[model samples]
Target: MASWAEVEADAPEFAAAVRRLLDAHRHKTLATLRRDGSPRISGTEAQFRDGELWFGGMWLSRKALDLRRDPRFALHSASVDPDDDDPAAWPGDAKLSGRVEEITDPARVSEVNKDAPPGPSHLFRADITEVVLTKVGSPADHLLIQWWREGKGLRVFKRT
Candidate 1:
């Protein structure tokens, strides 16, 4: 596993590229497993906070229900680069495998809500467990985790 130090001590260009992709996209399509073992997908507004993806919404929404049923979820953020818009153009995508937690603290909600673009509802946070750069074709497949220590590139905290 890559250490925090190694991921931090990465090439500036590569790091900036990753940040650009994450910042450019605000909407993520989250997938969860339904009670019957089916897949559910919904679009959500997300923010990168403290190196983790945070999302908020009405507690009664279908997406929220799915998360409540099964915390294991996947998020995908994607878009076309301004200069190109072809299938082969290879726009970047970030996939995160994590569990969702409903944060009920008004103070904490206010803090997270500040950075989130004005939206239609309340907010909750998700603590990312694993992330993959699908656009670059899975960094793990191309480079050893030990080679660059990709683990610490994005630090996430799970709710206790």
Candidate 2:
């Protein structure tokens, strides 16, 4: 697994692009593994802080509980539909997958975010395994997909 900081260190420009897409909207989609090993999608938000990607939830939320049982997760940035006449102008979308480790130390939580809930909550930091971004090529004739994986660095490909 790689920290978001590590991804940045390995691919600064690509990482920046991913971060911009993620922060472009207020809400994101989080996929967690349920007890049956099925996936559960939840509405959540992620932030880049202290060089890592952090996400959390309200106290005892189902998403939180799922993470407690299984740390594996995938997060997708909120996406906007492209105008039919200007698909090439679309900013594209980003998604990542990783396992999160809980943050329980009060001091660490406070250091991560000063606004952490005063009461119970579940906070986690992602140890990302992979990151991907997809977009329509400038001329709108093809699709461009860029991805980075732990130990594999970054790669890009285009498709018609």
- Taking all chains together, each candidate's TM-score versus the true structure is 0.63, 0.96
Stretches > 4 Å off in candidate 2: none
Tens-digit lDDT track of model 1 for 45-154: 77756544577666578887777777878777666653333333464565656678777687788777886445445565665555555342232223212112244454
Cα error, residue 59 of model 2, in Å, equals 1.3
Candidate lDDT (C-alpha), each: 0.58, 0.94
State the weakest 10-residue window (summed lDDT) of model 1.
Answer: 139-148
Off by over 4 Å in 1: 1-16, 81-89, 115-122, 136-160
Clashes of each: 3, 0
What C-alpha lDDT does candidate 2 achieve relative to the native structure?
A: 0.94
Clashes of 2: 0
